[model samples]
Target: MDTRNITYFMAVFDHLHFTKAAEHLGISQPTLSQQIRLLEAELGMPLFDRIGKKVVATEAGSLLYQYGMKMLQAERDAKSAMKELLSEKRGTVRLAVLPSDLDFQLVPLFVEFKTHYPEINLKAFSTIFVREEVLSHKVDLGIGLRGPADKRLVQVPLGSEPYELFVHSDSELAKKSEVTLEELTQHALVMYPKGYLGRDLVDDVCKKHGFELDTVMEVGSASSLLQLVEAGIGATIQPRGLLKQHSTWPNIVSIPISGPAPIRHLELTYYANRFVSKAHKQLSEWLIDFFKARTS
Candidate 1:
């Protein structure tokens, strides 16, 4: 009848030993036995059979076990739903972000967010397609250089960061602290695939500059592209924030670009009209402020 009684019964059923069940439940053996007896009395049936020191489930107990699991699961779900309704006290927040954002941007924001809401569990990952992850419901939130996501998703524009080129110090392009898109494009380009929001901007910039890109490699992540550039393989473009952070890379030269001055609008997006808990709102606002403060 009582949820606690069901839980105790399940524990006893699992162990099939009174002492072990009592130990597992952190209740005294006599107390556990008395509770089980009371539960059996309430149900009007014997729940267990004692043969020597071991206890085995009777027909009634086996049937209760079947229903008890569902009862516990339902109870747990109810509590979670209630918490989400009340305070958004606890739940997992699956998040997708770009690798460059992880170290400098999202990670710090997450640190502050957790400080405020320690009960919120987080799973943050970096991938090329954060928008798709959010749209498919694989992640509750996504952070990236925002572009056109599915109309079904909601976007919260955080801020914008200018894109720049990362070239090896010895490269001819590195001679200039600032270069035009046409100048940067002269070398082999190591960049994310065209599907990526940042890469799409790069493609547009290249087209506007009147040149088809000499994309030598279409890597999935900014880190890999940066590595290729760092190895003196070619020049790659990335956000200025990432370029500044890795500016100390021995042979890396991060040069600002000027033309249309392409800027990436970073956004936090989630499914539109989904039941966003208060915790989610609070965390999202915290992130908005965090990026705003950093980028400002």
Candidate 2:
């Protein structure tokens, strides 16, 4: 029941060898072995099977191992959250955000977060599948086009915006106030690679019309894709926010997606009911307000 015993059990369960586990724990082999024996005795079943020199968890031990790992991790997280909350002056908030051309959204939010919490170190990862990262404790927070289905995540509604078609100011598409899904398929396109959210949406629209997109180029960054468009290589489609802050770009122009447009939702998500530090709480509040403000 004691955490020390739990730790000892996990250590053994991880290494599957008493001596290595004891070495890692900085305890002697015999002492760790004795503790394991005591734990097995108290449980009324063998926790491990000794096959020659190798050790493997018994069926009961495997079940308990799962619970034990969660317990220790929860304890560690509790201590960390308490430390940050009680200290008040500084802490770290690890965040994962989709690399979905985040300059217009994430950059400003980060600037605001830094200005308010000057002492808090914000470590961010540019990634997709933001929800899984938070659940596994890989990061404390995330922002993405879509959030996780798991109940652990608390979603903060960020604004939604319609997709825009980008073309060189001299291009035919730019001459129109809006571009239809059918009209778009007439031109060659440049966009993110397949499997990305933006590309997936565009592909779906094309499919709905019983056609596939004429994607001539596939680049990774938004700026690069826009540059290619600006050079009149191909047209591109993306969220309006990706280019909102770059209003001065002379050649690139955006037109609305016509004929029943598809909109993408932006959201900030964090683990629900988990002990967050003081800085995290304030930042989460600020983020909610900031995103909600965008909606308004």
Candidate 3:
């Protein structure tokens, strides 16, 4: 089977829509269809079945997809290995990080990595769906909250930190070193929407304690949430590490939550079996050490 055709097939399989897959591949829809047809003819079996507006993969297509990913990964590994034979320091490492304080907090570390390996290209971005990006092979590494068990992934626990109350320095709650969950509910709060990872962590803890938070506003951006708190709108609960980054902002205060505080556990995850290039391996090791130093 042609590797190029296998690549096209996988794209179609992923989207289950010819037009969308074509768009993603930067090819015209007709061209994409022709490629699929050629691939099917070579295989001597139908790869996809069209049912009305939907496209579904056949058993043959499903089986091919499994091997197709491995084939693509092998091609990548070969290219990386050949490149390193010429210059050991050259390659790209795409990384996705949590779309919260953790994203911005890691900038210094990223910069340090770049300084050490100037030839390697580093592309980093923030997203709430870090695991999804890594799992889909869109990113080589992910730093985010713990995810559901997946044998295809290898997760290295970074560390866990407790959620603390962030309030304007002028607020009475800021005068205390810590506050109980019950006392915290007495105050108005600004929080992320229900489905957000950080919000869910807080919500789960509150549910276990038999009372809900008195949330006055729901904001999605972590920086916006802190801005609202600084404006004295309402308090927000976030990991203490987040507050540490904003320590220079005199108006905001971080108060620990007393008794069974909600904790956010983070991990660095990647494909368990995917090839690890030298640049990728170096950055991963650096990050592991960086987090270790921070938590220690």
Candidate 4:
């Protein structure tokens, strides 16, 4: 039997009312009735039994309904699969990044990306452990300062941005365009709260220099930490790219951290074992290209 006739039969079977089924199917009731009759004639049995105004499926009709459900689902599945294969619809990509990275114009870059690929959806978030999110397979992509990620994941390096010393304009370090980590250590430090990447980086560097960091203040958030630094409470170190992000900060001097300068590499990473969807791959490539153009 034709699939259209089968579909019409199921519609009538569901509604059990010719006029209602026809209206739902966007067809005339007489046309629906004629289609049902044609299907019944082909089957050599009455699919539905009607008594006065009531309608009920017969034994044959009950059996057909069971198969009809599967048939419609299979058709839909096939169409959807084809659409995906053709890239007719670009699906969603789950991405995790650092809050500082967001200030680096990543959000606007994603907006531009979405403009080109209208069907592709990009859901982004900021968290300290972007690498951990990728390791756990909780996200499709992670864009952040690279650290010890699981070697099992594929890391695509975007570029590296050097860390700079953020001090008050009147500070001695401000007199020089470049300062060493050892020199920045002479000033009181206001670092990010413990367990943060920036804090860990500074602590590790200081340890290598045979001294532990003595933080005068530890702020939980970047904005709040910058606020304290803006008030000249203490000096801090951050990526040059990150400093540019909050470029409106007043009375701040970002001197380059020279003499064995520690740097953070920005990267996009994904699980190596899992299938990388087209959306994920495209976004990753776009990020690398965008950063290259930016740093160039």
**For residue 235, what is the lDDT in candidate 4?**
86
Q: What is the TM-score of each candidate against the true structure?
A: 0.60, 0.75, 0.89, 0.62
The candidate that wins on lDDT is 3
lDDT of each: 0.78, 0.79, 0.86, 0.77
Give candidate 4's error at residue 228 in angstroms: 2.9
Q: Can you give the lDDT of residue 292 in candidate 2?
A: 59
The order of the candidates by TM-score, greatest first, is 3, 2, 4, 1
Please provide, for model 3 over 61-80, each residue's C-alpha lDDT reduced to its tens digit, 9 standing for 90 to 100: 99999889778877877787
Q: Model 3 off-target regions past 4 Å?
A: 147-151
State the lDDT of candidate 4 residue by residue for 1-296, as single tens digits.
87899889998998999989999999999999999999999999999998888889999999988777656645544554565798944666788987656544676678877887799777887887888887655577888776665667888878877778888887776799787777755689888877888777777777787876668998766666677878889988877665554457878878887777667777888867555555666788888886665444
When sorted by lDDT, best at the front, the candidate numbers are 3, 2, 1, 4
User: In candidate 3, where is summed lDDT lowest over 10 consecutive residues?
Assistant: 287-296
Cα distance off (Å), candidate 4, residue 93: 0.9
Error of 2 at 256 (Å): 0.4
Q: Which stretches of candidate 2 lie over 4 Å from their true place?
A: 1-69, 101-104, 146-150, 293-296
Residue 286's lDDT within candidate 2 is 71
